[model samples]
Target: MGTVEDYLGGLRPEQAHALRRVVELARGLAPDAEEGTSYGMPALLVGGRPLIGVTAAARHLSLFPFSPAVVAAVAPDLEGFSLSKGTIRFTPEAPLPDAVVEQVVRLRRAELGA
Candidate 1:
């Protein structure tokens, strides 16, 4: 999507709210992150990298970690959550864990020195 609003438009209210929470957490972790689009989804750029992006999928919201290390580290907690290489998927009814959200952002910031 071209903008956060554009991407969020397709999401249900709950999904949008959860994605917004993740975005907010990431922004708090890295205040200098620049808002932008990546892979046709709303993304946050930190230290010249797309640190995180969220897509509104047909059945759930998908979050791209943009860092394999972070994904691997949190793989255990993500067992119940649908996931791919760097993506964590959750439905509108199953919002992501806040602790996991914070961990991802904080770890990424430390890794990127942001």
Candidate 2:
């Protein structure tokens, strides 16, 4: 299976940079989280569960928090970003803020009892 770095390497430089920032945020929030592929995208695993997955699409990069509740928890802070039940879409030029990323990770971590 391809590794997270391999997945990031395949993306355009700007996309990779943006995704890397998200990965960094996750890592900072959950230092014990493991990096791997989950649901065919680069993911961080904590307490044996996937915390978040990131995908690079043609028009934007997507962050999958893997829980609709997590999205809803951060809904107010997600102004101007495209959000769905499981994903938040953003451009490389306007990636989600580190504060937003931390909020998502914290919410997921709490939900998982980690």
Among these predicted structures, which one has the highest lDDT?
Answer: 2
List per-prediction Cα lDDT, in the order shown. Answer: 0.81, 0.91
How far in Å is the alpha carbon of 13 misplaced in model 2?
A: 0.5
Worst ten in a row by lDDT for model 2: 1-10
Number of residue pairs clashing in candidate 1, backbone atoms closer than 3 angstroms, sequence gap of 3 or more or interchain: 1
- Model 1 per-residue lDDT at 104: 87
Compare the candidates by TM-score and give the number of the best one.
Answer: 2
Candidate 2 per-residue lDDT, tens place, 1-112, comes to: 4767788999899999999999988899899998887787778998778999999889999999999999999989989999999999999999999999999999999988
lDDT (Cα) of model 2? 0.91
- Give the residue spans of candidate 1 off by over 4 A: none
Q: Which 10 residues in a row give candidate 1 its minimum summed lDDT?
A: 1-10
